[model samples]
Target: MDFFEVINNRKTTNGPFDPRPISKEHQRILMESASRAPSHFNSQPWRFILIEDAKKRAAIADLAGRSMEKLIADGLFFERYRPYFRFSEKELEERGDGIHFDQLPGPLKPFAKQIMSPTGVEIMRRMGVPKMLGRDNRDLVAGSPLIMGVMLDKAEYIPGKLSGFYSIFGMGAAMENIWLTTHALGMGIQFISTPMEIPENWQQMIALLGVPDNLELMAVYRLGYVKEAQRRPSIDWSSRHRKRLSQYVFRDSCDTPESDDL
Candidate 1:
C-alpha cells in the first residue's frame, strides 16, 4: 500500500495483539521508519523507550489501574464531561448579585454555570460511572505486549516560541511511523494518553525512561498482534462544507484573485 494510504487506514487498536515476539529485522525496519520522521532544524527531539520486559509492563499497567481506581473513588471521572456543555457568562452574572462572572474570561464563565446546571447534573448521573470504571479496570489488567514511552527534549526550538509544539510534532511524526510499521508487520498499536497519572507519577515514569529532566514524557503507546482489527468510527466527511481554493488564494497583488486551478 502507498504510504498515504497507510496513514488513511491507520486506526487505534486496543483489542488483543499477537503474542509472537517481534523479529530483529522487523524491529530494524520500524526503527528506520521512525528515524525518517521530520524534525525541526534536523533536531530529533523525540526519544522512544521500548519496554519489552513483562515485569515493567505489568508495573506500568498497575499504576494505570490504581490511577483509574483513585479517580473513580474520588469522583473525578465525571470531570471529563465539563467540556461538552457550559453556560454563557451573561447567564452566570444574571443568576447572582455578588457573583461577578464578568471577572472571569468570557469563555470560562459559562463552565462554572455548567457544573451547577440541572441538565449537566443529569448527564453526569446518566454517564454510568460504574460501567466506565469497570472498563478502565479491564483495560489496565490486559496489558499490552510492547509498551513505548515517548519523551521530548525541551531544548528544541519551534517556530514562534512554541518549543513544546516542535517536540510534540516530532513525536507525532514518530508515532505515525510506529503505527504504520506495526500495521505492516501484522501487529497492533494503541495510544493511551489517559493513562498518564498525577504529576508525581509522570515525573517517576520519565525518570524510569532515563530522559533528561528538561525533557518530558509526551505519550505511552502499546503494541501487539491481534486477530481482530479494530474498526474505526465512520466519519461524516460530506456533512461539512469545505472552502474553495479561491476563497483564500491571492495573486501578485493583495486584492487580485488567483485562478483556482493554479
Candidate 2:
C-alpha cells in the first residue's frame, strides 16, 4: 500500500487476532525499520522484547488479571480510565478522541458507556457486576500470536535533562515507525495498557521478563494476522472520526491561524 493510504487505513485491533504466527523475516523488517527512525543526537533509546512463548504470554495475562483486581480494590480502575470511554451518545457523536461505545463489543456497548459516570459504576457494582470485567485485557495480551515489550535504553538518554525529553520524543517516533510498518505488512497491533495501570504489576512484568535494569519498559503491543473487525451497530466511524485539521495545524504565526492551508 502507498504510505498515505497505510497511514490513514491503520486500525487498532482489540479483538482476538488470528492465531497464526507472523514470519520471522517480517518481524525483523518491522523492527529494523523502526530502528531507522531519527533520534536526537543519534541516541537510539528504543529497545524491544518479542514474546513468542505461549507460557510467558499466559503469565503476562495472569499478571494483568491481578492488576485488574488491585485497581478495583483501590476504586481506581473505572474512575481513572474515564477518559478512554465516551459516556453518552452526544459525547460519542461529538468527541474525536478516545474510544466510543460503538467501538466496544456488541453486548458490552451499553454498559461500556456507563463507565463515564461514578453513579453508574456504583450501581453496576451494587448489582454484582464485576468491575474487572470492564477492564479485562488478558485475552488481548495473551491470546495474540506475538507480544512486543517496548523499552528505552537508559544509557542512550541523559537523566533529568533535555536529552531525557528528547529520548521520549524519539521513542514515540520509533513506535510510530513500527506501527505504520505493521499496517504495511498485513499484520495488526494494539497497545497492552492494563499492566501499566499499577506500578507493582509493571515491576513484576519487568522482573518476569528479565528485562535489564537499565531499560524502562514503556509499552506492550500485541501482533498477529488480521482478522475480521467487529463494528458496532448503527455507528458510522467514517463520518464521526478524529478532530478537524483546523484544531491542530497552525499557520506561520499562532495568531494568524488560517493564513495558509491549515
Candidate 3:
C-alpha cells in the first residue's frame, strides 16, 4: 500500500483476527516502525512486552475476564462507563461518535441497546450475562496470536511537566506507526481497553504481565490476520469517518477558509 492508502485503509480489526502468528520479518519491521516514531528530546519513553506464548496469553485473557467479573460483581462496571457508551442507532446518528452497534457482531446488537437501560443491566446481572461476557472475553483475547503491552517508562519521560505531554503524543504516533505497518503487512490490530478504563483492572493487568513499577502501561492491543474484509460501521462511514477538513483546518489567520493547497 502507498502512504495515504495505508492511512485511509487502516481500521480496528478486533472481531475477526485469524489467529495467525506474525512473520519474523514483519515483527522486526513492526518494532522498527514503532521506534522510528518521533519522541521528545529523543527520549523514547515507550516500552513493549510482546506475548506469543499460548499459555501466557490464556492467563492474561483470563485475568482480564476476572477483572471484568470483579467490576460487575461490585455493581459498578456499567455504572462507570454507561455514560460513555452510545447505545442505540439513534444515539450514533446524533453524536456521530462512540461505539455503534454496527461495529459489533450482528448477534450483539439488541443487547447493546438494552444494556444502556438500568433495568436491562439489572436483569442481565441477575441472569449472569456479565459473567458470560467476561468468559467470552477470554476466548477473544486468547485467540490473538500476538498480544502487545504498550507501556511508558516514567524515568524516560519528564512527568508532571510539558515534556510529559510530548511523550504521550509520541506514544500515539508510535501506535499509529504500528497500526499502519500491520495493515501494510496484510494483518490487523485491535486496541484492548477494558483493563485501562478501570484502575483495579489496570493494576491487575500490570501484575499479570509482570511489568515492573518503573513502567506504566498506557494501553494493550491484539494483532493477527483478518478472516475477511473488516466492516466499516455505517454511521462512521456515512461521513467518511472523519470531520470535514474545513471544520478543523483554516486559512492564514483565525476565521478564514483553508486555501486550495489543503
**TM-score on alpha carbons, each prediction:** 0.63, 0.84, 0.81
Give lDDT tens digits, candidate 1, residues 193-254.
44564666666556656777676678877777656654321110111122345656789887
Candidate 2 lDDT, tens digit per residue, 1-262?
8989988987776566788898999999989988999999887888999999999988887777567656655558668765666656677546656555454434555676564467665655664344444335565567788989988888766678887888889989998888888889888787766678888788888987899878988888788888777433221222335755565566787765453253
Clashing pairs in 2: none
Which candidate model has the greater lDDT, 1 or 3? 3
Name the top lDDT candidate.
3
Query: Can you rank all candidates by TM-score, best first?
Result: 2, 3, 1
Model 3 lowest lDDT segment of ten: 233-242
Error of 1 at 237 (Å): 18
Residue 63, candidate 2: Cα error in Å is 1.3
Error of 3 at 44 (Å): 1.4
Compared with the true structure, what per-residue lDDT tens digits does model 3 show for residues 139-187? Answer: 6788889999998888765677887788899999999999999989988
Off by over 4 Å in 3: 70-94, 102-114, 229-240, 250-262
- Best candidate per TM-score, number? 2
